[model samples]
Target: MDVCLLYFEDCPNWKVTDRRLVAIAAEHPEVVVRRKRVETMEQAERVGFRGSPTVLVDGADLFASPDSAAGFSCRVYRTADGLEGAPTLEQLRVALGLTQEVTR
Candidate 1:
């Protein structure tokens, strides 16, 4: 599975999402994780970034939402706790269908 973390500068949650992806990637080495930065509004539009720190699984947004007009903004994520800047690791695991068990 290919995963890409599309983000922009000044997005604080991007780092946390990056860390979570790193750990998740360890479990699925075959999954390639790429970081795409949206540097401008045009870039954001051309790339169809839902918001900063948009996680794309196999070229599709993990979170299913009606595509917005497309702009540079801070996107809020839906988490177990509530709306958040990023989803929990477990949420990501389920979304990606990755196992939490560590192979010995």
Candidate 2:
């Protein structure tokens, strides 16, 4: 699977997503992870960037909502706990189709 993490320089939440992706990659060797820095509104629009730390699996947004619009801003995720700066590790696992039996 090709996983691309789209982020900007200012958003700290991207790091959280990156770390979770790293952990997932460690367990799933087939997963290839990459990062893209969206620096401008034009770039964001051209790339369909919903927000910082957007995860794209196989070139599709993993958690995109119909209402999401491209912009250079922080992205909030709706996790089990509540609104969060980034998705939880469990969320990432589920999105990536990782089995629960696998642990870091």
Winning model by lDDT = 2
User: Could you tell me which 10 consecutive residues in candidate 1 have the lowest summed lDDT?
Assistant: 95-104
Each prediction's number of clashing residue pairs: 0, 0
Backbone clashes in model 2, listed as residue pairs: none
TM-score of 1: 0.86
The numbered model that scores best in TM-score is: 2
TM-score: model 2 vs. ground truth = 0.91
Q: How far does residue 29 in candidate 2 sit from its true spot (Å)? A: 0.5
